[model samples]
Target: MFKKGLLTGVLLFGLFFGAGNLIFPPNIGVLSGDYFIYAISGFIVSAVGLATFTLIVSLFTGKGYQELMSDLIHPKFALVYLVALYLTIGPLFAIPRTATTSFSIGIEPVLANEYKGIGLSVFAIIYFAFTYWLAVSPTKLLDRIGKVLTPLFAGMIVLIIILGLQQLPHSPMNVASIDYSGAGKAFGSGVLEGYNTLDALAAVAFSVVAMDTLKTFEFKTQKDYKRTILFAGVSVASLFSVLYVGLALLGNYFKLPDTFKGNVGTYILSEMTQRVFGPSAQVFLAVMVIVTCLTTTVGLVVSISKFFNTIYTKFTYITYVRLFCLLGFMISNFGLDTIISLAVPVLLVLYPITIVIALLVCLHQLVTLSKVGIRLTMGIVTILSFLQVLSTINGFHYFKTVISLIPYHDIGVPWLLPAVVGVALAIILPYQKITKFKNNAEEKK
Candidate 1:
């Protein structure tokens, strides 16, 4: 159990630690500056804390997200939610962004200016080819990503971190990228920044892999299952904390120029590494980014494809994988900026609901809430999410103003109060189990 648990934890870490994970912390460090301690504390709450909560909640249900969420929410809603979730994490945004980021930070800097476009094109093809090769076999995934790739990436990352620490300046510049005038505001900003990691959502989605790995290890007893999963979550969380803090400190130590500001996590790390380790840092970071991105991209492809094939049966898992990889490869050429721009609206809509649902899942036994209540709560979240997204557009300044009036809306989550109200209303309303129509597939199982 110990050995298997460690491997599963490492695998989970690999899946969760992608380009976004690598980029966010250091930027937070740069932004928070003197308030680093307060900021990182809040960052960990939403990043590591919520993600750990997600894993624990999924373990309780002992089922994939589809089954668990479907049982709680309507099956139709679950299907739509899942489809959007997978696409956001897969070809549509995360996967492609990984390639683009790797190219921009790791490869583009070293390439001649004339060859930037060609360099990105060639790199994307090679990157996705490797991803496709590794992801083609689902069972072999653990062998490749967990056993081999993750360890390699970890070792390299450790070396970079060690080198960065060795060369750390005696003092940080203590510059504030943003006005973190108070601990409360700094913490709130940190929490919002940490949302870019998307670790919580990945934890929920990857619950399928975690459960499957446990089954493969032949842990049948419920007690053993819980123990092993707890170990894995702790292991992943510990490692994430170490990496996040280390990277953030590295960013502070450097005090990079204003030219590198605005989504400069990759630049800070890359430049710091090069400064510490010389030209070799470029090669090392490039390799690390590619391997890290590939592991995550492959994991996304496998999980999404497997889920789709299981539910729809319109295509085989491999077929879905190929299609996703193809799509990811095409979109990757759009570059990191474009992908990030696209992701904002989708994430704004999805992240709050995900957080609320995961929280409800965790508190399921303690709360006397019906499915209707939960649905209503999520409905409020969805409406607010839509409003939030709309507020991002040029013509919706009024909506943004109104949303800003909500408590914590300034912190980026305007839907919290409405969701709470929905929950309160549910608890007060008459208790009733609204009978849901189960599909033929669900009936067979």
Candidate 2:
């Protein structure tokens, strides 16, 4: 039982970590400057905290994200929600991000200025082509990404930080990056950046994979089944916290000169690795990025394609894989900065909606929540998220003004107070829906 539990934990770690997740911590670390402590704290809360909560929702409920969400909300709504979720984390954003991030951090530093554009173009095509092959083919090599490469990649970050601190002169922490000078702003920025990782949202969509894998094992009892899953969830959270904090801490040590190039987060790790381990680390980083990102990209494409195929069997898995890889290839050439800039706002909107659902779902499991509360809370969240998006646009001061009326609106999550009211109304109102848990009695079997 113990061995199986630990093994499940290890497996979960691999599934959770990816090249796409590796960038944010160090970047937040760099940008938050002197306020890094507060920044990292907020980051871990949203990134690690919410993702762990998501897994628990899956385990305790005994329904994968889709099953549980479909029961609570409407199936059609869950389907639409999932489609947006998958695309944002799949071909349109994350799949392409894996390529651009790998190239910018791992490969671009070695290329001459004249060749960088062509270099990125060539790298993206080759990256997605390999992703397409791996998604459809499915190899033992892909398994190594989770079991082997993930550990090595994580260890490399730890090793670089330890070695660099000992060998390299530390740059004194100075002014915070543009908007991060204030502690509140830094922490809020960190929270928003945490949304960028998409781990929390992915946790729900990817819960199917984890729960399915757990089901394959024979546990002596229901307790054992739950224990094994808890082991997996806790282990992944621990690993993520250690890596994210370490990466963020290391970010403070890099001296950003006027000549510093590329994305801040990507550059910190790449530059730090180069300084600590020298030119050889560059080759290793590039190869690791390509291999790991390829595996990550393929996994995303496969998951996304499979879900779409499941919904509409008219398209074969291979066809969807090819389509997405082609899309990812075309989009990745827009570069890392462009990909991130567009993706963050979309994430900001999606994350809170998911978080509210996860929160209400967890709360409901403890004690039944009324449909009114659930519906009201979700409704307020959706409207607030829309306003949050509009408020960020060029000609939307009124949207900003409406959101400003909400307390704590300045700290990035303008939805909190309204969401609280919606939850409060649920408790006050007596409209109980007697919602059934899709897996309550039958899950253990």
RMSD of each: 2.5, 3.3
Q: What is the lDDT of residue 225 in candidate 2?
A: 83
lDDT of prediction 1: 0.81
| lDDT by residue (tens digit), candidate 1, 1-445 | 7777788899988888888878888777777777888888888988899888888788767767776677667678888998898888888998898888888878998888899988999999998898888888878877888999999988887778888878878456558655454677788888777777777777767888887777788776878877888889889999889988888887767767756544678888788778777858888888888888788888888888888899889898889989999999899998887888788788778888888888766656465557678888999899999998898799999988878888887667789888888777656666754333233476567
lDDT of 2 by residue, 220-245 (tens): 88898887777777787888898888
Candidate 2, residue 18: CA error in Å?
2.6
| Per-residue error (Å), model 1, residue 193 | 1.6
Give the per-residue Cα lDDT of candidate 1 at 78: 83
State residue 77's C-alpha deviation in candidate 1, in Å. 1.0
Candidate 1 wrongly placed segments (more than 4 Å): 261-263, 366-368, 425-428, 434-445
